[model samples]
Target: MLISMKIVIISSLFPPNSYGGAEQIACAEAEKLAREGNKVIVLTLKFDKGYACSTSDAKNLQIIEVSHKNIFNYYNIGKKSICLRFIWHIIDTFNFRLANDIAEILKRESPDIVTCHNIKGLSLLTPLKIKKLKIKNYAVVHDVSFYTPSGLIEWGKEKSWEHMGVLTRIYRFFTRRLMSYPEKIFFPSRWLLDFYYKNGFFINQEKLYKPNELGFVCENKSVDSGGKVANNFLYVGKIEHHKGILLLLDAFERLKPTNVTLDIIGNGVLMSEVKKHAQTNPNIKIHGQISREKLPEFYRNAKAVIVPSVVYENAPNVVYEALSCGVPVIVARIGGACEPIIEGKNGYIFNPGDVDDLVEKMKKYL
Candidate 1:
């Protein structure tokens, strides 16, 4: 027997506007719930020239896009000055306006379960609002944004929740207090789950180490051309310093192996630098931001996918995607990035920030 209930999912972003794995997962979760005969409501942000609000419905799902009332939209945070960014975070912390908007939707929908993902832009006080309505609220941890606004901790440069400045300490104190409103929380990896627990964030809440859902299974679509396995490698992610794009490029250049190629996907602030490297290295190809539906073609042909993130990731989707496609993975051993790799069976792991270790591992497929 199957039972269907009304569910409301709140995320900062949703499909079409989704820029990362977290948003994709939220969309998938909503669709799955709707397909199971449940009425699903997704409350997310709308980004336009003026941040317009709109609503639409399809099948058993309804999407309500609320305009953010902060100084600027969340997507423009990178372009703002430090002072403006600080002010924006403060406004977003409590976000009375945004909470009121979401509260209205929750009250109308009166959902059975309220699940939230990456509520940074949506509002940190979202869980508290849901609880105020006496609804069962659950949150999913996607990254380290709760600890730091940037959601980043460099592998070699940053300390582990230590040596916080006064402002940062104050920020975390309030963020931690507000986030504790969730009845139960889900984490994509044990590293992230432990991170929150160790920082004394969600001490009384029930925590579960639930790995990210694949959303869709990929079929092995391409047959290998039958050549040297290491001849062609793939990297799919943001092209930025924290993602270790430069490090991967440097290693590939050092390898300097004949007939070897590296296909880089995705785009970010480091696009110009990546382009400069691509211009210099004939063996490296930059395919900027391939659609999700078209990624399997690249995965099936490549010998292995390399995740060279220097930041402490909370389990990336690429590793799982590659393994599901029957391709091996060579990942950096930092945070939860290396959690899924079984070493020699599915993939291999190298010490983070170690060029020699990465090159040595790259040699195996050569």
Candidate 2:
């Protein structure tokens, strides 16, 4: 006999809040699971404008929005400091009130399994509360940066990192104590899992799952290729230093391919620099933050999509979105970006941060 289970997905961001890739994946997964005949529900933070909280069975899914103002909105060096991090952690510990509220919902719903995606905006206190309640829980780590507080302290902005020093060290020391509470830990990439294992963060590798292998489904249908006329190469993602946006711009400047253009989507702190580069160079066009509905059009019209992220991204939705549109990708050889691309087959790869190699690769595509 087969038994059906009810799943409660906890995330910090959800649809209508779509801040990054983690939000998109959580939305997609919840919808998919709901369609699969399992009762699915999502709990996410509420935006300032507020979100609609009601039962929508249209997609066989239930979306529950819990309202909470995000304290960490923009990058504040003071707030991100080690002393601040500790203070924030102490304050966040009181977020057990929010977790207890979530626990009440879980008890009322009586879900068989509690699955959590990104909860950076929410609180880790919720999971611990749920575990104490004796609920079967799974926490999915989208990125390794959050596992240890030191990871954030090291990789975050210099000012923030400096502020986070001693407090972050303390947090890192106690991370294992908090982390070991989770019954199951889900990692999107083998590379991430191995990295954590090597770092002694995660001992049991069996808990990690490579869900990216299943591939993502694109909601928009692929546009007919015959009518598309643009010869532009697309790069869709946040314009951060870690994303290697500057590297891409440098490479594109070096190539200087006549009649070819580069369309950059999304906005970030480095927007001014990127804009300055675009102003001097006529070939680069910056389209800041396009809606998900409009992304298909960008992918379809592009000659190819470029993913030049320098950091080890677990699995970027942009790559999946591009491939789903049948648009070939030219991604950096580092991280999980190279997982989908078969070199010359569906896409191409170049050395991370190598402007010359990237320029050569761009020229070949042009």
Candidate 3:
């Protein structure tokens, strides 16, 4: 029998406070680790208003929410100069306070292994801190944040990811050096692994693991629908510009599929645009944020789930969720989102940011 070990999950955000793919994936892994008889403790940055340090409990998970000097949690960060943002990241590159907090937590609850995830608010200095304790550690690369300040590089149209400027190169060099602190590294997609390897990341790391913690056995799906639901499509992910919300809106408007209605179920920077389009067009509806527990019901009844991400996705949990409910998927052919989907069977893959192609696919539903 496999032994259950004590595991610490460190991520930028956790469930109930998550708004992106990485956080939700972290939450799933933490919960799964707990259910498998391992002790799981989640040390995540808290982003809610008026929250200091707090503790909470889930079925088999222990959550420690740490408040920090973050751009997301504080409004003052909005007014600061762009240089200041760089400074904030630099400070956290080996943040003294962040290390101390983790050290203190370690004293109280020692873990066998620490798994790291998106550390934007937590800091890139996180793995180094764990190294000091001499514990087995590995980081899950959900984005390019470890190598670049913005985590996202310019892609689309005629642009692909390229080398950064002098300052950015310097920033990435130091972070990439620090990136080697972990004993091992984990990737959710081969594309992410390739990105890091081609750029000389974790060259000296002990081992590498991929498709991390994304596979799950879906529960029996049952949702309360007053009557038979028809021709309803679902979009359950971030509403950012990079997620292609605007493209989806354009497609829905131009095509004007009378037999179909789109249910958008997430929040992000582009929420206003989603709402604006919804107001003018009755076919689009914004449900804002909904609990994960209730999402399967939406998926169970939907004709298909749309993942119109413009950027390369490591692997989207929503895509898996949709498939688990026996719902078909309509995803962009970028990175790992297209991996799980078998075209014309469970889903269709379209060119990234192609509104007309998306519309043509939607027309098939009617």
**Runs with alpha carbons beyond 4 Å of true place in candidate 3:** 1-4, 46-60, 67-81, 157-163, 206-209, 212-229
The residue-by-residue lDDT of candidate 2 on 147-231, one tens digit each, is: 4443222223435543356755565455545556668888877766776666566565247665553333443333335764558
Q: What 10-residue stretch in candidate 1 is worst by lDDT? A: 50-59
Order of candidate numbers by TM-score, starting with the best: 1, 3, 2
Q: Model 1, 1-366: lDDT tens per residue?
A: 244798998988777776688887888788778878888888888886644433234468888888889988787787799899889999999899899899998998899999999787878888889989999999999998888877888886666443266777888899889999989999999999998889888998999989977733655533455642435899999888988999999899999977888999898999999999889889999999988888887888887889988889998989888888888889999999799899998889999989889998888877
- lDDT by residue for model 3 (47-94), tens: 666444333444567888776654444223434677777677767776
The estimated TM-scores of all candidates read: 0.93, 0.84, 0.86
lDDT of 1 at 208: 91
lDDT of each: 0.84, 0.71, 0.75
Per candidate, the number of residue pairs that clash is 0, 4, 0
What TM-score does model 3 achieve against the real structure?
A: 0.86
